[model samples]
Target chain A: MTDTILSHDDLTARVSRIFQRAGLSPLQSDAVARTIAAGERDACKSHGIYRIDGCLRTIKAGMVTLDAVPELAPEDGAIVRVAAHGGFSNAAFELGAPELARRAKELGMAALVINDCTHFAALWPEIEALTAHDLAAMAMCPSYSSVAPTGGNEALMGTNPFAFGWPRENTDPYVFDFATSVAARGEIELHRRAGTPLPEGWAVDADGNPTSDPEAALNGAMLPFGGHKGSAIATMIELLAGVMIGDLNSREALDRLGNFTLLPAHGELILAFDPARFSAGREGNAMARAETLFDAITGQGARLPSQRRFAARKRAMAHGITLSAEEIAHLDRLEERGLDAVA
Target chain B: MTDTILSHDDLTARVSRIFQRAGLSPLQSDAVARTIAAGERDACKSHGIYRIDGCLRTIKAGMVTLDAVPELAPEDGAIVRVAAHGGFSNAAFELGAPELARRAKELGMAALVINDCTHFAALWPEIEALTAHDLAAMAMCPSYSSVAPTGGNEALMGTNPFAFGWPRENTDPYVFDFATSVAARGEIELHRRAGTPLPEGWAVDADGNPTSDPEAALNGAMLPFGGHKGSAIATMIELLAGVMIGDLNSREALDRLGNFTLLPAHGELILAFDPARFSAGREGNAMARAETLFDAITGQGARLPSQRRFAARKRAMAHGITLSAEEIAHLDRLEERGLDAVA
Candidate 1:
């Protein structure tokens, strides 16, 4: 076969069907599928169809509640609480985002707290959801305890991800999502599979000694980006999103799961700020002012984060997402065999 | 030649006298003095008495208002606004911190916005202020446009400072404050003064090419920490704390000042979160849960941020702060001749 091309909607529908057949409810499957399709559309392969097997593994292992109906708690002053009930975070985020935007507009700023969720999606999706409402937003969450804190030997903190977004008038919103670790665990696993040496500063061996051997790194711990500063940020995510939300932190999540093969269950914190409300009596228009800043960055040839992803998204929208024969075959298998196709 | 020692109160009084004599109002002098003293007590010499001459230089250049009382805008939802009237940000922060704490408790979260202020102080003091109220807090502010965005050759952003703090029940709050840049502008300047080579990756020359010469680096642009991730965060600070607050961004602040010798006038954003309110219906106590995370960090031999500073603070409290004879002589001259003591 030459290749397969599908529109964004078609891709989403296909992914949703696979999830639905694998036992996920429509509420969870549709929301989760939308994010996976977005990943493919944006050409972020790491988060794209590649993630389906891992998610299905979690489902088959009973680590995720496939039929959960995420519920939003009653109004809680400047806070929108969503009980994910051990389900995927996507549906919970969708259930809470509208209220988050409304509360932020009303209070100048507000936070969405997601509890008891199996979270694995990129935070940018949630960030973009808020930015679509013309708001600036930030989100963070902890994952498996695979990264060591700066100056520590063992893995204690997760490769926690932090994301932020700002709204724009007629362009894609400015968005960035990144792991605090110097490199992702997946990258190390890839290196191991290729029998390649890992990059320096990417990891430490079992004794916390620096190592370039991918195998040693896998048996050891990943390092945080930018050394101590990044480590501090990861720790902050653990405190704010995990501990402060009264949910499982990275260590607790990892301990509960017992292995990294399954998705981790934890809490997430998303804060939204209404630019108009924040700049109510200020001198300049907040949106226009933001444009000026963006111009200065791009004017100097400094590429803004997420530009490549947006470019891919534009192409996908215009032409359609292209997949190889193998990928299509895998999708077909997933659709046919459901959970059995994963493990 | 022996070192001189003085109690924290005595040191604060001495710094206050110098500022008062140099034409600052008692309101501004006292608040600024406290910060300076705190810096010394915490063994942070870079932010200690060393900053006095810089503050006086800004005053001598007629860049700071001598006796402007910061005004607090009426309560507007979750925002507590303070107009610094072109004075130092210290007093403005003092005026709004309590209200920020109160509002955060009432609404689960709140923001303190300080506008039209000359800011040169470390943000940890402000973070500590909120943490004292048993609230988690974060603060960010734009400075002179001296750092380049990642992938850009020119300086289009500031070495923006980002600070965060979490309250602890029986000890110093967890806090971390750092510049987004790889190294501080002051560090580069010191290297130039000492005729030392700049560290690799710290900066680029005028042509945007990497340079190790301190002089060339000073003339060029400083690079951000963690590459693009740090650049994105610095940009976020400019948008949220600068443009969104209706105040000057790094470029505007630098342009208005015309030179980097004086402190940049801009805005500051401080967000306060009441953990008690955030974790109200959750299972565990937020404070106690935070301690568990801290224990894990220490147990693994990974030092928590600010531990060294807290150690210094303890020493200072027990034995007073020690200053070299030359530092004391400089203080005496500043006290005797006021602004005339410096060039």
Candidate 2:
């Protein structure tokens, strides 16, 4: 099959049309579409159009309550818990971001806990928004289990994506989002599809021995990046987002949403802190001196974290995003199915 | 030099005598001694008796205020800043712990930021104290610059250490403390002392190329573990502890102490959250279900995060801790010189 190019507008409109036809309200459709489009624009292929089929399958499987609204889940002080009520996590965050920033501003720091949600989009958008208010933000969501602990063999932890953003005075915010696993499962799948071998220590075979065969690794499990240290981090994410929030852990989430392979049942946590509240060097302290840290990076000719994505976002918007033939076909199939749902 | 053995009480007593004679108040001497004893008990050589000489040198160089006290800096609601008044961080934390726990209980979350302090002791002591009140705790302290960013050639970041501890119903609070660099500077120093080779990806040569020679790397910089991911985490720590607290950044800390090479002029942040406030899981929810995650680790015979330290601590308390002959000699020398300082 051939590749296809999509203008930014076209990509979002197409995604919106599919969700709308599948019974989501236009508001929800647009919100979801924008998230995907943003991912594509940033060249985060795994999170963009690639996730549509899974989303569609989830919707068809009745895993998401299309009209469900996120409600305040009885929390106060510096921590706020929001019950997503089985809604799309993107919408939950959209509803909660303002409150989180407001509370953190009033009290130096605040955390948002979200549970009973399906989160498939890239998490950067949720946190990156906080930087606009000069607030530092962090968010984590543990999805389907695909990786194992450092020494243990079974796939027991999710890809557990973590994101952090520190606002600056001028340039784009310093933001980074990454999965604790050695590589995202989608990336490994891509290698498998391309008949390529995986890199060393990326994954293990079914018997728990390290293997570079992408398929075997997929049949088995992904390794935590940075060995034990990364494994501990993944565990920490689970404890913070899944266990601490009283949400479905990876195994529980996967089990609860049976047959819904496209949906990532998740529990998430969001934390925000006002940089202004930090009183050091009011003139040129931590908030202002962040530039010095950046200079060190750029000074060393090293690219800043997420610098690549920033560039990709700019280029993709101007030059357009590309979709593989198979991905394009899947989108079309979903569109046809969406029409059936609409009828 | 051959290794020597000393009982835990003896270790603390020896350290205390040296500090007290150096003009430190007996109270201050005991606090510093207790912190060192705790490290020895954990079999953590880097932070134990081996660090005594450095401590003595720092005090002798007039870098530390032996009679200084921790004072609450002007701050409000849910956040408290403590000025260590150029004293030991252990003393600062000891003074702040009660208020930190009290405020976290009252407000669900509270942050304690300490600046103008010397912090060379193990950090676990700081956070582990929070668990006594069933509060989840996290702390970060940025020390001297020795690790470089992923793409940077120079050591622009500190071996920022991060620590977190979660309280459980019946077990020891699950705790883990780690430095963001590929290896702690102390670990590198050990390799240097033993004349052992460094591990691959652990350090870079002066020209920025990867090297495994410990001395060469020590003369150069250490790599951040997990490559770019760990490096970003280090950056975050610097921003949070060094920059946000208005204390010295890693390089600044290294530069300020001038000829005072033994001190780690640390700016640290300690955060506490009452897990009881986590509303998602009142009974078997996230806060309480952390036990399930712990089981997943120990069930696999994989050691829990701080399990080794706990065991080592127990054994050392019963069987006594060990120090090297050189370490014993240094302590003896310091004890003799302490009389001169007092005189």
lDDT of candidate 1 over B140-231, digit per residue (tens): 99998999998888887899999999999889999999999999998999999999998888999888899999988888999999888888
lDDT of 1 by residue, A1-343 (tens): 7799999999999999999999999999999999999999999999999999999999999989888999999998888999999899999999999999999998899999999999889999899999999999999999989999988888988999999999999999999999999999999999999999998899999898999999999999999999899999999999999988889899999999999888899999999999898888778888998998999899888888999999999999999999999999999999999998987
Q: What is the C-alpha RMSD of each candidate to the true structure, in Å?
A: 1.0, 3.0
Clashing residue pairs, candidate 2? Answer: A243-B286, A286-B243, B182-B225
TM-score of each: 0.99, 0.93
- lDDT, each prediction: 0.94, 0.81
Task: Give the per-residue lDDT digits (tens) of candidate 2, residues A1-343.
Answer: 8899899899999999989778877766777898999888888777787677777778777878788778875547887777777778877777778888888989889888877777887778887889987899888878877888888777878888888999988678899888999898878889989999998999988788899999899888898988888888888787777776667777677667663266877768888887778664333666557888788788887778777778988898788988899878878877887835321
lDDT of 1 at A315: 99
User: Which pairs, if any, clash in model 1?
Assistant: none
For model 2, what is the alpha-carbon lDDT of residue A121? 74
Candidate 1 CAPRI assessment class: high
Per-candidate iRMSD: 0.8, 1.9
Please give the clash total of every predicted structure, in order. 0, 3
